[model samples]
Target: MDGWHDAADRFGVPRTDAVLLALNLYGLQTRLGARVRLQVSVPVGAQARTIVIAAGRPDSPFTLADSGQLFAGAELVGAAVRTDVDDAVSGYLRCWDGTAWRAATINPASRSKCTGCAPCPTSLEPTADPRLDTEDELHLLLDGLRQQLPHGGSLRDLHEITVSTACYESEDAALEAMMVLRKVLRSRRIDARIVLLSSVVRSREAFRWLAEHVGPFGLFLTADCVTRRNLILKKTKADLLPELMPALLADAREAGLDTSFTYIVGLDSTKDMEPFLSAMLPQVTLFPSLQVFQAHTPVMDGLHTPEADEFSYFLNARRIVESVMVDAANNLVPEPWRCYRSLWYESYAGQPLEGPRR
Candidate 1:
């Protein structure tokens, strides 16, 4: 059979207008496993229909019949079959939200309760301005999250609440939002850690303020490249990070907060990150930590497509960081392993810190 063929007949759509997209077999080792989620996206005419088939390991020569219906109680739910031919299948999911079909998901395992609209942990992408949101906006959004949680889930039940401010008006505004959000979560008795994104720590003051208010929050710092030229290309300031990050790390250690760093590889160029890593890793070790690694992805707009060389850069960077940390740990120095987040918690917080929830 063809890798992709017309699905008009099987799905009851017009043959001339419908096409069967790839049947993505996920969680498969070599063949179908004991459990797998089959995500099929078929475009009929101008619209599309996606069916998520959940099932156990199927018989050889896999067929849809082996997969059971996607159930919402006794009623099976899915999108309508379109009649037009579209070449590409957009992976967005559709579900009946009581009244009409809307984009949804089957992941998070909690989304099984999706009744129509998008699920909780609702996205709050910041705008070009901070005042773009009213004071009550965030509280309302949190209320919505509480309402959307699967019947028995509570705010405390969540693992972590990640807030990314990649496009905020200013650092102060982002800081204010973080402070307010911390308060909102605290009032609800939700103990989930709040993971703030890059912009929240744009300056030493902002970083210090964040550490003071949101102590123990996670920092998701994404620096794709450390070179000056690439930093300019990415519209990131050169002096700010170099001067602020180390200082901020020191401050965080003193204040008993945790931070993590992510470096993206293969942006403007692929080369040795050793010099950069060597200079910074020691400073990073001076403070408590979560994670540090080089990640490369093709979906990033201006970055080069990650090829073999890019992969090499990523692997080499990881190897060097791990080796350095290992060497430090093996030495007979007094504070050999006190730089990790867990160490700080063990010494200061009076208890071992648990890993951040997913």
Candidate 2:
């Protein structure tokens, strides 16, 4: 309840609704006795608030909830928060519209996207992504799609295809690959949309192309590192990302793109991560993802997982962002906590993520 109360305080979620959402999340622990963290998809005002579980491992369980594997009804109608506010903040949800930012309303995209084009995500791990360096490799990867589809699925079964900019030599190379991939999908008569994961640290042209042609997909900016000093993409610095992100996100937002930031937690000190997050939090729109670091991965670079208070970092982050940004902006901000858009916030009270409840 206290966790819910804290979330309600930050997100402006009603105590009643907070209690309900908390209970439902807690029910996961109560029933399965398996540890789970609480995560949300958007700010409270939207009519259809999503309770997306990052039930994904760093790249698995925490991502599983939204990765098209479970396909369950991830959207939870908040027991509260929807009202006139839903209209006011609807502009914010335009990013998740999965199509265009200015789109007045968005239908359940999966009905058309998920079913028509089950979305063949042609990918390789981003860290080792340079494998798709040339047209030959890109051609080979797309050609091999037939081998990658599910038991009976084919190219036509795809409504979405994920391409990570992190997996390319340059954003230009990635965009060129998209161009080649687009031609291939078109030739096959497969009308699949591309879901691009970009770091936004690269040249803006690739994303600019995506916004203009692909009709605005959620830009998941991957940073991987999280400390004040190392918070950066390959060559870009922390200072640059914050400045660069808003313009890109705002442009995408104006053009109708859902935007988010992704980082690895437990890779750096949460205390160092905190001030970094505080400085960076307000620069973001959608819930910035904090991927719980997994030790099993080959490259840890000497950091250990922070025993998973990872997600609750949001509540405090909300406070810091609001306090700081508010002082800077001189406004009465109504909603600062995007509790509904993040994970593990409730772990502080009772329902912990992957660990036994307190």
Candidate 3:
């Protein structure tokens, strides 16, 4: 109850009946035996307020104001939400498209380890159209992205593009969409680097296919936590992520693609930064393009506000990563564009560290 009001207050809107109904409907649909999060906030580049509903347990209370303090952790679950919070919050109670959970069961209360081989559903369903599939939606998305650019440049003038989905239907479907997008962009002489944000790249073949098909593309893999308990909290089957990520990166490298690992700090249950960093920094050095993101609890994810200490943990972790990089190598060129605190290596004085060439 307090969490609900906090969300409303953070959004600077009254807790009207309409908002309550939207939140309740979203909660019920994604409940699925675990607590569903109802995030009420205004998104960037939008006029009206928005409510994003996703499946997960809220371990803490979070508000719109806490966005800056949010750290990425293993408990993060991507959502497929129905747009609500317009005059009438329509499509509020839409069920999980079963896309995000195709790799694992939608359960956060489980105590056992996931098999890691949960079969992904075969049927490719489009929860969000145009951008998720269809050439028309892609164009619309491009138009929207272009509108945000300064001086109003077209898609061809853009240097980079990130194509993401709540959950990719499959590797094949993702490849197909990429191919279509590539063809369209090529026709216009638009050769922007395309980055993919999806969950279907666990297989070696998927990595190979991405390397072969997508031109100047990269995959964003978020390793929120290394512990099994945190992985369970995030409702992910990636328990072996720490072990498998190296192999995955090797596969991507072999295929001539860049794979960037994103680490989120400040999970409620996670306190120590050293263990996570100790295990992770080596990989960061290997990849050299690793990203570290701050975490916040989204109301829709049913997560709690990060503790004050959690944010501090994130700050300290960032400092430590930078320090480690400096010690490990001499030349640490800052890549603020990659991430605010990211370092792009030019050369290690003698070792010759190679950053992402593309």
Candidate 4:
């Protein structure tokens, strides 16, 4: 309940804040397997005032003010909710539709505070000494993602892996970590691709070496924001990123390795986003892939959190890329953009690599 309330504060009315509120409340009441029903009635005349009906049995129906108007017939059967919101309204409804929760649908206009109900896993956190080695923690995190793959299946089927290595202080350590990952996958007979975080522009030798050995495989570079000034000052202090990204993408392509860049939304407050799009869209066409930014786990002191609208803008940009470049070639799907070696690597390897790359 508190979690939903906090989120509602951020997203204004006429949005999915209410749906999230209802879902969270329903989850709490039914945690013990007790069936719960929430009926929302909006008065025809009173646009602001709403009536929420919480009925569990014939004996009682609790009615409350719909200040949030979040409860609108989100019910739970013996175990699950009945009037589930469809995909169209799912984003506005905030309810998880049996498969997974949609973070993009969350309204950023609401005024709710995040409760951090689930803290990031300890293994994903930075080390205590800051200067201390993170190889052990990194392995633990990677192993965790590997454990998530379907049991008894080959690793090549697992198409995606998200890593958090972009924030690491040591690029060498990051490269070494990937090497260890490659060794592990080969041992297991799983074929998979890799998305590396952090600016590898300064470490051309390392990246070149990676291209020589792992380059035949897939590689994704994460830059969230497009401009060098903003990325260097606000997001990451690496100035060489802007120049390095294009070069790296070109190098990867020349090396026969599939490559792409990651762009985050809502990083800047400027209204005219066309310039950013202009610089990135061309790359999306020329490059192998373009991963749009979505609000995932918060990082860099919460610098990555984007307004819901901004996130939507990023998604729309991806659509533009798909329609213009990918659709033209019928390569809209990510699989086609992946490196040829990814197929062989995952087939010969086992388990998926996890965590952001540096």
Candidate 5:
């Protein structure tokens, strides 16, 4: 019998309009390894309709046994059907309507949920002392570097300026911080890149603004995991990730900006052990920068404390990630190993100097 499946194969079906089919008894028993009973629905005017064709049950091949149309109107094509049966049925079949297949109505609520809304400011005022802004610290750091340079000096020559910030409660404050940094860098003629770490499901407007202004500079997204569950648990809005991330990265790349992903290891139970290793190991193609979780200076409360030996896990995970990069190089994946140095906590922050230089 002809059904949606046959039509789908004949004409490449879009996932948005695809309907699944299963034979009530024969197919269920064969596939699921159990005696099963089920019911299915079809359009009212479908051709080649077949009902239960049991030998002893009835003479007529097809019958309208149930009351009310299982589904109605042009919008019922991919709509799901619910049914129940007392015992296992013998078999089932589906028929296709002659004209174009029915189209299901899109739920407005579902569409809205999928489409992200504009980000609202969480608070009117800055949560921390405005005087304690990191921008000041950054300016001072740059000034210190300048003192060490020759008469005709530049910070661009020494260390590449890599700026990063945590996603606090307010997006307004974050933007403000970014703007301040941008102004300072431009004024000082410093060649620097900004990495905005946001836990929020960013609004399209925010992304557009970032692209238009900071698109030329580098941008990196920092997330706890690639999955939604872990993201939600970390107080991050999951709807924006994976999909949003790729879009942002694409835009940045097209704009000739450096794009990267930063992930902290040992963040969750799922992100530990084999699953974590497997998830991160193969992502070398993605060129992810890695950071290990430090037990001291906890970023979030109630995180699983890593054991002393777990340092080995971090090292091993790094090696695996590098190995995947090696494979990519061997396979000749274009732009394999971008050569961006991965930084560890101690190295980036620097080890405490035991004594002053003589």
Candidate 6:
């Protein structure tokens, strides 16, 4: 309970109703053994609510104000959630979907062992260091996500699965990681859309190949992108990014993928905000997310601390992007925007996100 509130206070994200149910995912792959269950038994009058679960941490639980938005580790993969609606804390209960008894098990995940990237910052799901986890230990970790659980429900039952292993440092390593999951998912029935967060956008050829072979259905967030200031920081960065970003955004849209940029607020680049939005938002089905630059990152070195007004950033971005919407009058972010679950959208704008992007 203390972990919950401390993290929520730091990040300004909402706290989950966390109950430590005493079950642990102690070396989960060795046996089909551990399952932590939760009961949803409210009056039938409460039937209209949709339940959303947030991953609670036992320690060290925040990245700036991002909250659970930035955590990844082997233990996170071991975090399985079993919604035992019918059981209901040992009394008569009904499932939210009107079934007498229904249960589905899902899990969070960790990254592969390939994890170095200068541009990519660490978050919630961090893999063990390459030296510490032996090849065998690594294999066991992958099995947590690849292997099925001991019931009708599979680990893939997770709504918006985040795959955050260290394999995305290079193009080849990224491909290798995605291929392994592709192979596992080939014959399985999967309803979930896996969001692949990667830093290796080295070439359009590589991205195009991945999109074509992997059948990545549209949506890419160029996380390392900053506007004019980024180009000034390193000219090579200009060649690699700003130009390449919009090109890929256009390419992805042509191929039917929704693409958007990431704006780092408080950077010198925030000056580019209006023009950037005017140009980019029209191309995207989903608007770009403005992230408050924490100023702690290595890339942010030598820059003054951010004096960004987050509420203003959110408001301005919304106003510009809303023009592109057919329903321009709607104050809420449209349902299709994927990053809302983790972003402080509701905190700044006073509107709850419709749902997670899956």
lDDT of candidate 3 over 1-358, digit per residue (tens): 4443454455333433213222322232222223222222222221222232222334322222223221123222222232322111101111112221001111111112223311111011122232235556555555554454445334454555555332444567667767777766676687876666554566777767766776776765555445443433333425435656656655665677766565434333334445555444443323333332222224213332244233333334444555655665633443312431222222221233232211
lDDT of 6 at 220: 42
Off by over 4 Å in 2: 1-130, 133-139, 165-169, 200-206, 214-216, 226-233, 236-239, 268-289, 296-358
Q: Residue 30 lDDT in model 3?
A: 22
Q: Cα lDDT of all candidates, in order?
A: 0.36, 0.40, 0.39, 0.35, 0.35, 0.37
Give each model a TM-score. 0.48, 0.44, 0.50, 0.45, 0.41, 0.50
Q: Which stretches of candidate 3 lie over 4 Å from their true place?
A: 1-131, 150-152, 228-240, 268-311, 327-334, 337-358
Once all C-alphas are superposed, what RMSD does model 2 give against the true structure? 13.2
lDDT of 1 by residue, 1-358 (tens): 2211223233322221112111211111223322232333222122222222112323212233223322222332222331122111111222323332222111111122212111111121111212225437555666655565555545565545655334433567667767777787678886666655453365556666777787546665544345553333233323345435555555654555555454433332334455554444554422222221211111222333344232233333334555555555522111212111111111111222232110
What's the C-alpha lDDT at position 346 in model 2?
Answer: 31
In model 5, what lDDT does residue 131 have? 29
Best-fitting candidate, scored by lDDT: 2
Model 4: lDDT to the true structure = 0.35
Full-model lDDT, candidate 6: 0.37
State how far residue 175 of model 3 sits from its true place (Å).
2.7
True lDDT of residue 351, candidate 1: 21
Off by over 4 Å in 1: 1-132, 200-204, 228-244, 268-272, 282-302, 305-311, 328-358
lDDT of 6 by residue, 267-319 (tens): 43445555555555555655555443432233433343243323233333444
Candidate 4 lDDT, tens digit per residue, 1-358?
3433344344322223233223322232212112222232222122121112122322221222223222233421111212221111101211122232211111111112211212112222222212212445434434544454344532344443323234433667667756665555555553455445445433557657776665334455555454434433433333444545656565655555555665444444334333444444444322433322222123422443344333233333433444445334533233311321111111111222222111
